[model samples]
Target: MVSVPTHLVSADTEWSPLRSVIVGHAADSCFPTAPPHMIKATMPEEHFASFRPKNRFPASLLDRADAEVRQFVQILRDHGVLVYRPKAIDWFAEGGYTAAMPRDGLITVGNTVIEACFAWECRHREIELGFSEILADLEKDPVVRVVRAPKVERPDALYEGIRGFGQKDAVNGEVNGTHTVHSHEWAINNARPAFDAADFLRFGKTIVGQLSNVTNQKGVDYLRSAVPEGYSVELLDVTDEHAMHIDATILPLRQRLLIYNPERVSKRALQKLDLFKDWELHAYPYQPAPRENPPRYMTSGWLLMNVFSLDEKKVVVEAGDVEFAEYIRKLGMEPIPCPFQHVNSIGGSFHCTTVDLVRQGT
Candidate 1:
């Protein structure tokens, strides 16, 4: 039996004994709408045409995704973890993205839940529409603090001043004004604080993050100021030009062992942070094959690295990734397989679908 956690929002590290979490619903999920440059920068090239307004995901995919999520919830509950569900919202009606990827909007660090300042306008209301109630409930504990995203008066300012803010060919390889260049120039300008919560990961008192198509320098600064005292946000120099979220780039299986995608981030980048000095970091050696059936609309095949840890010894992985399961097993982790390809069809896998609320030993 699992013991109840004293606080509702208390998690710092990714690999801990998860006591409570929020598993998202997949109903009414739609293809998230964004400006041409933004969409071109982050989404799959073949699926760009489907990202217009009011484009709902195929009904068949949503149904299967919901089933997978429900089964995932059951598996978590069977392990004695408390699960929270968000109120379903019609993404097509709200002109927003699906709530199935809550890790993109909310990050629980220490005892605080900080909402992301979303760069895409379609995702601005995601937390308010689907997760307000859960935040309210979490706030019932005196120790839990919910740091809401500040309203953006001029959302378009984020993309303004760029050479091609709305053009299809704007983000094609040239460095735009003032935008930091990594593998490629970032899509969004540093006009306002903008970040998806998935861009940052908590490691005890230090949060490691990156600037991507959706995350800017200002966003990193805002996160640094919003985190609790003694907590600091550090940026890693990742090499993925198509980067949006950082979950697939790195995976921390437990306290000392971490698995990373060598294709996106280099070993030197990981070494830049003192936090990993004593930790073991291994680059994923195998390249994951692309799924043709479900069709990854938003992410790459590297989503295989997006596994979630239930504790230091056990992790939740996609059922079909037997090769990955076996690989991690050799590293001393038991992979609990669950079917999530349909969930992958929309966006993200286990780590992207849920937010760890109460992990013991934080």
Candidate 2:
């Protein structure tokens, strides 16, 4: 029997039976504007020009994206899962990105929900403008806790000393009085804690994450401090040079079974973690074909791995990805196909659009 959750926020693993979640809206979602260096580092080269200030995604795309999201919410409701929607905001007016991908801004660990300290200036106010009301409502639960990101006083300091395009070079730096130097030169410096919540994934008491263009060492340190007691965060060594979010790198279908992108992460690297010592890890055998008509502006075709799990037995997948759907079916999962290509074009897929608020067990 599934136990009822007393708090409004509680989730530790990605494959648990989801009871409540937040589904984002894609209306008025503008392309996120950032420094040329940062944009070039993380975004796809073909879509570089779209990262201009106040540039809205094509109206046709946003309309279809919003439709897909609404349909997705209805599907969740039909399954008896509670769904929360963010307050719609004009991204063009605010000079910010879309509220469509809330997974990048907030993560739920145990009974607490923690916000991300975004590296991009345009995303600093993302959660504030879109999801504050929901956060306030969650706070009403006496057993729930919300940890908001500390306000950044000097955002430009993050890019002060960085130079050149994507390359690997060492640079000495100081973050919070500790001297540090990374082997690879990222777009942003470790001036402050900067990370998108999507960089980390939960697995029972052990939460695995990665250091990417958007997430820095200081950011990981901050996350370690914010998580509830008895929970820990570990970093995975990923090979993708243009790494941003780890959601596509690793997908945990359930407690003991996981599928990973071999092009980005290795089976050996996953074995290094004590958490996966007794788990079954499989490399995704098929290569996803790129989509051109709608155009994947932000990510690669591997976004197919960015699926949302409804529970241990049922998972949400893109309607077009029949290959992946069939593969997971062989692994004992029921893939519910939904038309989300429009949403994929905007930024992310189902996993990137929803934040699970409550699961059967923490």
Among all candidates shown, the one with the greatest TM-score: 1
Instruction: Give the number of colliding residue pairs in candidate 2.
Output: 0
Q: Which residues of candidate 2, in runs, are more than 4 Å off?
A: 1-5, 165-183
lDDT of 2 by residue, 122-169 (tens): 999999999999999999998889999999999888877776433332
Pairs of residues clashing in candidate 1: none
Question: The CA-based lDDT of model 1 is what?
Answer: 0.89
- Per-model TM against the reference: 0.95, 0.94
Per-residue C-alpha lDDT of model 1 across residues 66-160, encoded as one tens digit per residue: 99999999989889999999998989888888999999999999999999999989989999999999999999999999999999999889888
Candidate RMSDs in order: 2.9, 5.0
> Model 1: runs farther than 4 Å from truth?
166-184
